[model samples]
Target: MGAWGPGIFSDDLAADIRGDYRELLEDQVPDDEATGRILAAYRHLDSDEVHVLWLALAAVQASLGRLDDEIKARALSVIDRGEGLEPWQEAGPQGLARREAALSKLRTQLTGPQPARRQVRRPWRHVTDLQPGDLLARVASNGDTCLLRVARIDDQRVGAAPVIELLDWKGQALPKDRQLRRLRPRYRDDGPHRPMTYRVARLRKKDPDWHDAGFERVAQGLQQQGDDALPPWSYCGWSQLGDEVDRLVGPPKAAQ
Candidate 1:
């Protein structure tokens, strides 16, 4: 049976899935051996397809007290970037989310109270119920002083909006938080080469009350210039905020 159903895959292909199954069962296979199994499984599957297998490997590694940076990294990537929802879509709806949860927990386990790059024990804030096209937050980026907007993928079951995407100032996609199960043992940085931040004062200059709005046309123009000409000002996924972000969680209901 295929991931979603029997129609998407053939019977023999299903049978071969078992061969990969045993490979997944072994807990303490040497690095070379574990890697080979992962590779073999990889040839026949995608990151999302082998999510469990990768998660298992990371767990086992932790059990054995082994710290294989590369293995951990790959596992984290799978967790962060999950399987797409529709057969036609590239990523599943909850893929990135799973990785995010996993990453948060993993860091605590690995570094105790102090994780690299990020501080430990930051208060967690999130949207309880998310819908597609619900604007998250504008993040800071690598460019001189520009920022980019970030949005989540649409949920198939929920009939959400599609993800309007763009490359950062570097022509690379924005950084993404991974969604692995055991982030501590197998966490990976799926975040892009750069993380985008809010433009703060400059943004205040435009109109303190209005942030995401009025920036669409400017973002579009910068995006059209491509990464090369981004000048640290390239925008990604910045669509109309006229009624979208406001209706969801904009200035009106925002807490002071």
Candidate 2:
């Protein structure tokens, strides 16, 4: 254990408090804000002391949020840290206990008559900037298919945990090193006001047909939307239940 300093609570109390905040950060409520707060919570610790923090942090960081893009980003980060082993198993149990305790307490505090958190509707934004490595999706409209990617995530679009999606990206399977002569942007519907969807017109792999092997693998990692927005998402599925709430509260109107 590190030396207990004056002014702060005893090392035990401080550790518990830090653990509480860390646990809270691991839960779904504060989602994005938790990253910065968790990093800041460790500010006082020396590098050596932070190793365990990083372990616990890395473990839960992957699944704590509902946003697929963010979850994938965090997973790739944590998995890259070489945590697929022993110490993780040892620390996992206690860490979950701490997480449970913290979130339970949060529910109590948040539900009190005077309550705490301000009412907010964080929703996921649409994805943009589709690339070779992204998972592609095709939605059906008017006998044509449109491609989409869950690209960006923010608190405003998805409250606490939100996701942003991008449409009009080519995610079709292409053979390695394939090149296309034309990129196709297709509309799902023939009628006016139809949202646009884009796909690669033709793919060639130094031969013929591009393979979407990589995208096919990543497709499982992405979250999908349905019957709601252009790219096909319900707030990126952060909470489909929020639909009724949104029904009660109308969407904001843009400036004319």
Candidate 3:
């Protein structure tokens, strides 16, 4: 696991463990079941990674006031035994000292009174009915409309969300199928070095902007042979839709 610091959550695996545990809790899984699922999920890890996982999960459970006795014992044992310190030892005495301090702090927290059990609210998961090749019209508040096409559906931890391609067409009315066929998809500068063709904007039911944004499905199942070859973009928020559309279609026209 990649670790940037000595803190419990500084490691990628530890952070992922925390997120996975909370996700299970948010889904209303029992504490024991969540713990079991997490352990089972990471059971293939080597001895060092297993120690890190146990410590991370136990710390998270303790903070949530749902710490199991067995988990706490396991974490404390790892701390006492100084397991999973090989990387820190390699980093030198300073790094090892910091890691040991972090472990000491965690041990104290685990042994102390935990906060009362907190309720984990289920997040509003975005589920899209749009399939690949479905055409959509995104109507801006100022009456301008931009066309977008669903390139693919990504099944994510929350739910299935559409990955869209912004077509290079903006007007007051939807264009003909033949007209759309000739229009190229817009590209955005991903960074200094890369330009991206697809935008993965997550549209959650709970997002107020999504409800207000005028979206209409105009066509469906229009997949072309090369549509599958488009590179995927990272997921973005629904709120970024207007700015992204503006970048391709220009800002919304002023109202009379």
Q: What does each candidate score in C-alpha RMSD?
A: 22.1, 20.7, 3.9
Sort the candidates on TM-score, descending order: 3, 1, 2
lDDT of 3 by residue, 1-256 (tens): 3999999989999999999999999989998899999999999998668898889999999888898999999999999999999989999999999999999999999999888998988776767667888887877655678888877777777767677777766778778878877766766545544324454545555563333455678888767666665666645655676566666565656667
The Cα local distance difference test for each model comes to: 0.35, 0.36, 0.79
Instruction: For model 3, give the 10-residue run with minimal summed lDDT.
Output: 192-201
Expressed as tens digits, the lDDT of each residue in 1-256 for candidate 2 is 3323211122353455445544564355475676567667666866445434443443343223222244334434433453322432445776445534443443332223332333333233333233332444332222222233333333232122212233433332532322321223334434564444222211122211113221222342333334123332232231222222233234433557
Per-prediction tally of clashes: 23, 26, 0
C-alpha RMSD between model 3 and the true structure:
3.9
TM-score of every model versus the real structure: 0.25, 0.21, 0.76
Q: Pick the candidate with the highest lDDT.
A: 3
Model 3 spans with C-alpha error above 4 angstroms: 92-94, 129-131, 138-146, 169-174, 187-196, 202-221, 225-231, 249-256
Which residue pairs in model 3 clash with each other?
Answer: none
Better of 1 and 2 by lDDT: 2
Residue 38 lDDT (model 3):
94
Q: By TM-score, who's the top model here?
A: 3
